[model samples]
Target: MFLEVGGNRSTRRKPTVTRENMQTHQRDREMLIWSNPGVEPTTSLLGSQSSNHLATMQSVMYELMSELNDRSEDLERQMLSLEQRVEQLTAGFNALPAHLSATLSAQHAALVHLLRERDSRDYHRAAGGGGASDAGAVVAVVPLSPASPLTHIPSLQLLRYKLPLLRKRPPQCQL
Candidate 1:
């Protein structure tokens, strides 16, 4: 009796069984068993390939993580530098009004001194005297005039009219 094994080729085989034919049939059976979908491949055959793929993926992930960490650190440093710069600018801005006020005070003192000297010269001339020979040595007192523009405009009002021009506008951000 002939037993059909593989395909149509097995149907044309002689009914007699020989040793070489038995070995060939065993090898074909072994191939079929190994190729079956239900059978799992041997771990020894797949181990090196899977490990190599996993190692490559791990190295790539490590490199990406390192790059991300470096960028984050760089951004942090930049933010810190920006904050320090802002602090310096804020200090300068806070001191500006005091500096300007001191300068205006000095100018006002000089102007008052000049006006007093002019008033003294006028008084001496009206009293039928020539210009003072030692004008630098003279300390003259002058009465305040109610009609002066300076008396009408206070320093605080001047600052109010001018200070808004120094204010910074908000920055517009684009998407």
Candidate 2:
């Protein structure tokens, strides 16, 4: 059997037609995959589909960000309102009674004096207008026994001194 080089049916030398036909075939195959969506595609087609999916996801993210921006504006307005209410409460606190203000100032001054006495150990020097004193200035006067009678009293003292004082006891039996 001899194979003929030239076809006898059609003698068309159109290169553009062949290219167009190939492009159309590719488009048809892509359309089939796109329409049927369950069918997986080759690498090139998969890449295009992935890029399209990414673009769709990006647009959805933008829409969500826009919605969040609107909510943020409303939250900012609410925060400003809360701040104004706090300012009003602070102004009311500023209008407290003069006695209360005086008490607070006296307590603050006492606290400062105590803290200075604790840190410096020079209360007399401070009172002497920064004079060099011979002795160490004693500031604090702590009690010798800080524990209460309930926890620290001797058992004999508790029975003899405290219990008899609290309740009237019967006459002691002469053993």
Candidate 3:
């Protein structure tokens, strides 16, 4: 009789099966079909699915990179605005008269002297001088004054310790 393997296709007709041999013959045929080594059918479909997944992942990564770049630009703009505000404040303060600047400087010097004296008195009782009293007692508050000695400028020290940004600004004053 015709055999239906898996689909509508049929093989050549054979003798009718006897009841005793039917089970044994079917088993033998099944074993022969299973033992034959052949390519799996699903490989092409699985490979295509993997490629699609990789493309989707790459698209997501590109979108995140673009977002990060946008945020970086925003931060740069904010930093520039802050710098401009600080420069405006400095200029306004510098425009004060020389007499006023000198008065402010002298007041700051007096405050520094008082603070240093107070600190020394407090620490003297605890540490008992220990021979380093002279060094520790000198509270150096270098006032950011426009009139105080040019040699006393703290920004001069910062020039050596600086990155490239400060060096690029036009020097309005020589000192």
Q: Pick the candidate with the highest TM-score.
A: 1
Candidate-wise lDDT, in order: 0.59, 0.54, 0.58
Residue-by-residue lDDT tens digits, candidate 1, 68-122: 9999999999999999999999999977766665655555446446534555666
What are the runs in model 3 whose C-alpha is more than 4 Å off? Answer: 1-43, 93-99, 102-175
lDDT of 2 by residue, 1-175 (tens): 2233457553545344466788888998889789768765676678798999999999999999999999999999999999999999988776645445454444434533544443345546477556532221222222222222223334322233333332222233111
TM-score of each predicted structure versus truth: 0.50, 0.33, 0.32
lDDT of 1: 0.59
lDDT of 1 at 93: 90
Error of 3 at 13 (Å): 29
1 or 2, which is superior by lDDT? 1
Please give the lDDT score at residue 148 for candidate 3: 61
Off by over 4 Å in 1: 1-39, 42-47, 128-175
lDDT of 3 by residue, 1-175 (tens): 5444544444544456677589887786667556643523255456678789989989999999999999999999999999999999888776765656676556545644544454566567768755434322343556655556645555334432442333232233222
lDDT at residue 86 of model 1 (Cα atoms):
100
Q: For model 2, what is the error of residue 13's alpha carbon versus the real structure, in angstroms, after optimal superposition? A: 41
